[model samples]
Target: MRFSEEVCERLDNYVYRLIDPRNGETFYVGKGRNNRVFDHAAGVLDVADDDNQTLGSKLDRIRAIKSAGLEVLHIIHRHEIPDAAVFEVEAALIDAYPGLTNLQGGHASSDRGPMNHLELIDKYSLPQFPSNPEHRLVLININKLEDRFDRRAIYNLVRYCWRISKSRAEKAEYVLAVVRGVVVGAFKPENWMSATRENFPDIPYANGSELHRIGFTGIEAPGDIWNLYVGLRGKRVSDPRLKHSQNPVRFWNC
Candidate 1:
């Protein structure tokens, strides 16, 4: 917590932590250069984006610590890290402390491969495939749930199913909602929260009877018509089956 100005200036790049002095618990993790730690502890608001409130949570947390009349405990965990490696180190720290208020898991250089929501929106909007044509995406094969492959049923499942891991659901950045070998819809999940009958009362079948009400995300459903590839026999799509295409896939690449 104590470093002379001369010592601080010598630090090129580092990963640091902000600990709540009262409890000795780490509440935030970040990576940056000299004096970066002080800027955060000083509560400096730079580059204020009108719409982005994610960083505000961290600032609020820091304020709460200061309100208790104890200075924030700052620790430089790693020093002299190059710009390229700092992000990865910061991400590792975040993963270690999962409940930290920091959002977006540090900028670790495209964590989920190249297929992200922004990139895919641009990909499909401009369908003249790029020179690197191997686009990867998380495909949700609704065909497996044959009886419930329609729009209405699939919607409820993704939103209400507690069985689905939070990471898996989010990784489906541009979900290719497939049914009977055709791509019927593309959905982007914004965020996930525990489902409740009281909140999502309109979910046609959830009559205060679901055994588990946990992972729900508002689906960004595609518009009326979509591009679906009907196979040679107009049967199910085999080439990109969940296993075949390595879909339901992690680390999706475009």
Candidate 2:
């Protein structure tokens, strides 16, 4: 049947049909402008259109008819129907035709449940921390600080490391390196003990004083302190004299 613009313009208040020729089944039932019928017939509907399987089934029926050398027989329109009435009518019409029944819902179904922490981690593909010698050792040292050190000591160490590191960027690398060393056994424990004693020999280990003398502090509350230590240690390793000058008191603070 021919579709005219006039018929489509009047379709706003009606339900429309595109039927299959071979089995005489109702394939699609929808409420829209008449021009939409042509658009559907042309197979240009958006993804959401699949939500109405009756329409999809009808289109398939039409394809079967074409393959069997039959032409579309009719395009019917009934005007002045509310959207609710159109839906009811379409559902009833589809139910009436056994051949046109759609048992599965229109869209694809998913079996997934709410995501937990592990699922979230997997979905995002979070970085896998080093599992072998390097990272395992780092994790051990990270845990040790929790057990063996006070917050203040950690803070002082980190702060002192920062002071002598030369630059902020280098400080971060230095701290990370120290932590890594502790974890992987790269730096000997005895060496660390000696270095700590050499840097801070006095009592109360007052803030800024011991740090000024030895140029290294332990990690403290403000976790970023390690960054500074890392930088200074990196520099000191590269050039021993970087940490070799007599305490600042002899040079500037006297």
For candidate 1, what is the lDDT?
A: 0.54
The local lDDT score (0 to 100) that residue 223 gets in candidate 1 is 44
Q: Which stretches of candidate 1 lie over 4 Å from their true place?
A: 1-5, 48-52, 108-254
Q: Write the per-residue lDDT of candidate 1 for residues 50-122, one digit (tens) a residue.
A: 1234467778878888898878888899998887787778877776775787744444222222333644453
After TM-score superposition, the amount by which residue 100's alpha carbon in candidate 1 deviates from its true location, in angstroms, is 0.9
- TM-score, cand. 2 vs. native: 0.32
lDDT of 2 at 67: 82
Alpha-carbon shift of residue 66 in model 2 (angstroms): 1.9
Candidate 2 overall lDDT versus native: 0.36
